[model samples]
Target: MSDKPLQRALGTTYRAEMSCGDLGKAIRQAATGPTPGEHTLREARVMQASLTAVGKEIEQQQEPTIAQELRTPVAAALADYAQDTGEILNAVNDAYIDHEDDGAWQDGKTVRMSAPLDELIDVLRALSQSPDAYADLRAAHVRQCAVGLAAVPSRAAGPTYTAPGRNCAAGLGYYDGIAEDIPDSQSKQWRSDVLQRLRNSMGTPPAYSTDPAQHITASWQRDAVRQVKVGGSGFLTDDSTRILDIWATARGDDLDARKLDALQEDMGSDACSRAEETTKQLACTREPSKCP
Candidate 1:
């Protein structure tokens, strides 16, 4: 009934757009005081450790699934929540006389209880309802991959082995546009140079990906083409880097198996079969497991 703006004694303000019960609860707690600190700081610390342990374990998985990526943020939020919760709990004890005033209740006031927990809950909800909730996380990861790819020293500016389906060429083109918005000028040029080099040597037109929308070969041709490419330069350029980067950023990994297949592709197959021993050695240097 008081017209005074409900101020948080901890001096933190939450968003005004909370759902029905949340806004009412905030008002009621502000009018009265924080509930007696039930859970101790030790409990909150334990929760923090657990969440951190879980997050690290999840991160250790090789090339995470979309579901795993989504869960990644949730673990981070919960860990942060536990940390903040511990602070709040510590600050709400009997001796915490800092913010006491006339209207303050016996238990004293402290930071908002739900701020961090609300963040964790929001992440969980977004996982189910919001498609773009983790776009920034994915975009950041894509940018890292692009930068790493770009940083690779340019080849000796001479002829290199070309794959049958131009899979490596197409892979380069696939990431050209994806990296278009990247800030570094050199990073933007690397893929283009590689793609152009391949196109020039491979006799143009069909050397690039025909499916611009898909940015690669047709779905039906993908398996066979990727196989041919894998046995050559395509394994490193296409399957190992570009495809994995884009698919991870887009929250899908449709061709994950192809990555393994590329690694296992016979040295005596496809374009590699025709390549000089020096070229084959170069490829093997990039991935020792593929060496004959």
Candidate 2:
């Protein structure tokens, strides 16, 4: 007679109705007999009555399953977006900082390039174009620059650094021509010279020669390890869920099963503890003096 039993019966009927497209017929059939793997009509009625008395119990147990299912994808999506955004912003800030400190760009009056900053500018421009594209590209650029810098032969006087975009004479010649042609009062000859120098030296380094991928990959790998150690707090905070999703997807079934098992175990343990506490409370209510 309780609504819970009736609601459960109606739910069963509704599902049948959806499949069969006849609510009246489904309800009548449900009332008359059991469906496959379910109780008979009489037994179902008894079960439904029992369910009504313990509906809240069932709901409490079921809530975590629903919460976890919903949380997994949502959390992963949020994490991925955050990591991508952070990577782009970090790369841009690094580039700007490095450019500001370049010896050629300093002194405020003279602009000289031990190596041209144009390539760095190009990398920054590429990153500034879109937030999403920047992470991989910035990683690539950083690795490449690091490798190139490392490859500089060791000398007694520290390491000699070669500037990109500074070695070409044609670029300098063009700047000289531009400087001579511009009227002294109207011309920014020094600016023209710098521009010419940049034009001459913009060459793409050999892909095999530079290992930005390795450096970037190594850096991320180390961070990932650290994050895992800190109970995933840093990784979660950084929104690295997408990266994890990618890793999970690539790893196949074993990892997926492991993840699900861990979640279930955690939920199960918490549920048991909660149930025991609730039982104690209920017992105390039944006999106040005996509770002690």
Candidate 3:
């Protein structure tokens, strides 16, 4: 059945999925230059499905090690996709639930500030012991911030006043603190894509200081000019369908557009003024204020 060629093809597909290789862009480049056989996201999924069947066959034959080798990367990629979906849903739901009561007890400054500090300690510990884990953990954490903050819109567009949380600016600052060792090569696109969303999501006044990349100055400007295509590979593209799906679930799967608009309006400002350090804004909007 010529299984050797098929196995090599599947291996190529596996690597593409692992690296998040983009086929459309690859094809465009191929017209003028080298066209490496990179699989698209859809092709990768099909390869993964086929691999799953092959993995089961190998497992049934008691070649468990072979099966594990075949399946682990695919499993890890799926896990990444799942975790991304969950984070997006949570951030969106926070924005979706707009109300005065919702703002109460919603103070997240201490929680936000403290957890990252502790994680930083752990990352430092991992510096010598587990370098790969250190890089991977920090990258995922940074990615989480980009996705989570991007989902929050602004005070004008919808509910920015979630109970107990840092504002978008604070979150970005926290991200910047931990991301120093992380390379711009690894973190830049995810950061840029979500930060770009911030430009419009906040409605007219815009919630943040500037496009977050502006904080990077020269590198930031380069990124803006060089951004290619709509959406991106890896976590950048994960939100495309995930956001709409979770939004539907947030609305109880209701397709009623008017109801959705009403839902956003009803969320109200009830916003927590999370600008604690600047002396620019109060930390708490609700009484019994705990923010600081």
Candidate 4:
């Protein structure tokens, strides 16, 4: 009826969805808080639905540019949510298959992993109330499926092994080389060189390193923290899920527990050792493998 209602909705949605505003604050809070419950999920759904309704109302307004401006962030946020959740669901399905193949399905190890499916299905049903929403849902699911399929590993090229390629050594070697090339400011040459004078004048450090060990130590520490979060976010929350899969393959034991048991813990230690040795064996040079 009134543009006041539309304007208010637009402003609130803009702050929440577009800027690092209310939604960002909520995300920061949630990151530290206890695991969110169904109430949070319901509130999120209501907010999304209200935003979609507001977008539709904006389409009926006469102001062309203003309406488009209000719609963009709402659409972008919805699209991002759809894409990310779709990727996560696809990954869950892959994990189910992996567990099944490893005989973990028979042992009911996948039960807890699939526990959220029923609630997710209910949410999807509510979201797919219209033909347009159904189309959007299908598109998001298909896009993530494509990404998941593309990421599936093939057997290694080696004659003796049928396992997936373990190219960590090559990748780790490259990272180590890059870290080594970075200059440590404490070096005498770095303090005395002519070009170092210009760099020092510009408040830039020298471009050479005499002590790569310190650089490697700090860089590896940071990378270890970063890569753990990256892998966990990409796959599952359980840090040991993928590792246990590897253990099951190598040790021929289906560790059916929620967390790693004593034997699985021992297997993890062996896995770490074998991984380090394998990296050393596979590296181009006869250097000790560096762990991150």
Q: Rank order by TM-score, top first?
A: 3, 4, 1, 2
Candidate 1 lDDT over residue span 1-292, tens digit each? 1112232221243354554344334333332223322333332333333333332332343211224343434333332333232222223233323422222222333322232222222222222122232222222222332333232232311121112122222222322222321225444243334233333323111222232213222221242233423122232223333333332333233324554245225212321332233234333433556767
Better of 2 and 3 by lDDT: 2
lDDT of 4 by residue, 174-255 (tens): 2122222223542223212312222222322121143222222223222223343311112111222333343334323333
Q: List the residue pairs that clash in candidate 2.
A: 79-239, 115-163, 116-164, 143-212, 144-212, 165-201
Q: RMSD in angstroms, all models? A: 22.3, 32.0, 18.6, 20.6
After superposition, which runs of candidate 1 have C-alpha atoms over 4 Å from their true positions? Answer: 1-11, 15-128, 134-136, 155-292
Instruction: Score candidate 2 by TM-score against the native.
Output: 0.18
| Per-candidate TM-score against the hidden true structure | 0.20, 0.18, 0.24, 0.23
| lDDT minimum window of 10 residues, candidate 3 | 110-119
C-alpha positional error of residue 12 in candidate 3 after TM-score superposition, expressed in Å: 6.5
Per residue, candidate 2 scores C-alpha lDDT tens digits across 11-92 of 6444422432243233334433333222343433422232232233323342111122212222222122222222222233
How many angstroms is residue 176 displaced in model 3 relative to the true structure, after the best TM-score fit? Answer: 19
After superposition, candidate 4 runs with Cα above 4 Å error: 1-78, 87-116, 153-292
Q: Per-residue lDDT for 180-286 in model 3, tens only?
A: 32334655554444344433222221222453211222222223234433333332222222222333333243245564445433222111111112112111211
